[model samples]
Target: MGNTSVVLRNVSKQFHRKTSGPLTALSDVNLEIAPGEIYALVGPSGCGKSTILNLVAGFDHPTGGSVTVDGQPVSRPGPDRGVVFQEHGLFPWLTAMDNVRFGLDVRKIPDSAEKAQYFLRAVGLAGFEKHYPRELSGGMRQRVALARVLANGPSVILMDEPFGALDAQTRLSMQELLLDVWTEFRPTILFITHDVDEAIFVADRIGVMTTRPGRIMTELRSALPRPRTYHDLASAEFGRLKEQILMSIREVIAAKTE
Candidate 1:
């Protein structure tokens, strides 16, 4: 995937509930993620963080304003945008290698066998190509999901709490693997997570969203050194950033309650 820039201009999303009529999930949200950058969105539950990712991924459209990738308007899902959800979403019947190859095959991409094998190896699933989703561990299934996306040659990778379902240790390992793969592939990423520490650990910049009718409450650049490790989680700098983000979120929650 080539480096691509993502821009959201005054974006708003409204959903109609059967009982509530129209509900605004996001209101006048604006953001920009530069080429090859990792941007994570974190906020209170139902803050529309995933809504932002869905809009950027072209899975849904904003009722107002625009979303563009590399200056082109986003109207629908395309090969240029690949998404990974909290659920692995792999085929039950397909082998790990075949699941990845399915994406390339859909795109009519040549050399899918080689590409599938390459990404499986990249995600540390080199020997599990023949394993089915049911046979693999949670982490391995997520790796397959990731490999499927990477194999598609997308310019942007949209992840919606992809590690949220994992155990603490596996989550940490997946976070580390994600950073390593991001460094190697350099695809622009838009990640949505509830964990503030996870956001701080993996992102180049973190955006805190306001309580629903969500908007960017604040944006913080992460200064923690790269090739980050578990040890870095205990560092003063990491703690400082964590505190800053938590304080911002606490303010949002406090205001809501008041």
Candidate 2:
């Protein structure tokens, strides 16, 4: 039963300010994500959701406590964890295929070109491999970015509002594509998003964080079955879960104002 993929034990993060003094971003945040589990985090605008991702990605260190993956501490970014951001962080100079091949090259993996093509095709961008980031649409660029991450074959994925910038229709399509890819790869994911519906749609469990100096307020398990579709969003079970999360968020907001 020892299948913990990632763990944050009483983690806290604080930012030192020159004028405002020390600012606490996260406080005593404890979380455990099981191997291959898709866990989503939702919270208020400034509630340290992205900060948590930064810590997990090893872009930043916690002020207190510890962050670990697979029983080992995370001191720096490694090949075991892959990250995707809100903006498609692709190089304009590199073609789609090359961007995907970048990580493979770093790892000195043979057949990198072929591997890149496979992942690009997996993300439905086969013919667009030669297209530069400037030549691709926002959605396509993001697809390339995702292909880059997937090509790395990391055991854990950290996504920070990956589809937040897309339009409604495009975002839904991306969501479907993500679920399909996730079903195939089954990597443990820690997804941070403000959209409750998106969290419920893609995650096995939804973690809600409180206001400033953020900490997980509660975690809600998704009863919705796998191979989920847009149609499932209209189900009674979906509405029930949405309302439950909405209520919790409302409570947090109310507390913040008071």
Candidate 3:
């Protein structure tokens, strides 16, 4: 409903190999993510989904074309864009609260401890604030990572397979946690995942990408009513949409193998 928070125009990325020929990761990628909407990028392994996230985060530059956040060209990473990577990336030395406050400290924000506790509570880690990263489970560490990012109050959140490392049950719980957080914060999210079910579960729109030299193959709007539950997956409409997405991805994989 709000303006576009992130935009990619003809974005392409290439990695040069010293021994082998040049490798192309993404080609001619163009997409606009609306503010407060959850968008999922689903693709096969090595299909450049993470590359796209990096570009948006300004962690890596595109070899061709451009990426923009809030109508301005993204040339470097900033507080305006918060990234949650697949790895928790928490500091082992820091407690959960300290890890969440790390960014605020770097930014020289006053009252870092107060801001950190607010976000830690928001992510359901209020009581465990004193625990170090090693003391927490994989999912809890990720929650701390999410809290760290959210505490900064970025306009856009770019996630690259943030839940891919978790077990099925934990992944579902994290999805629900993310949904609750999104409902409250309303930050524009661009999440990357290979799981079709996960995409449908979390996204307002799903973008399927090709195997390599990845490009947006299709954008499917999720018409399923919000506040989604696992029970929705058993419904006829959910099955129909899942089947369609599976078929499309299957074709792309088959073509790549041929």
Worst 10 residues of 3 by lDDT: 1-10
Could you tell me which residue pairs clash in candidate 2? none
For model 2, the local distance difference test gives: 0.94
RMSD (CA, Å), candidate 1 to true, equals 1.8
lDDT of 3 by residue, 134-221 (tens): 9999999999999999999899999989999999999999999999999999999999998999998899999989988999998998
Query: Model 1: per-residue lDDT, tens digit, 1-258?
Result: 123499989999999899969999999998989998999999999999999988888889999999999889998999999999999999999999999999788868899999999999999999999999999999999999999999998989999999999999999999999999998999999999999889999999999999999999999998888888878889998899999999999999999999
Residue 75 displacement in candidate 1 (angstroms): 0.4
lDDT of each: 0.93, 0.94, 0.92
Candidates' TM-scores? 0.97, 0.98, 0.97
Model 2, 1-258: lDDT tens digits are: 268999999999999999989999999999999999999999899999999999888899999999998888889998889999999999889999999999899889999999899999999998998999999988999999999999998999999999999999999999999999999989999999999999999999999999999999999999999999989999998999899999999999999999
lDDT for model 1: 0.93
Question: Of the pair 1 and 2, which is ahead by TM-score?
Answer: 2
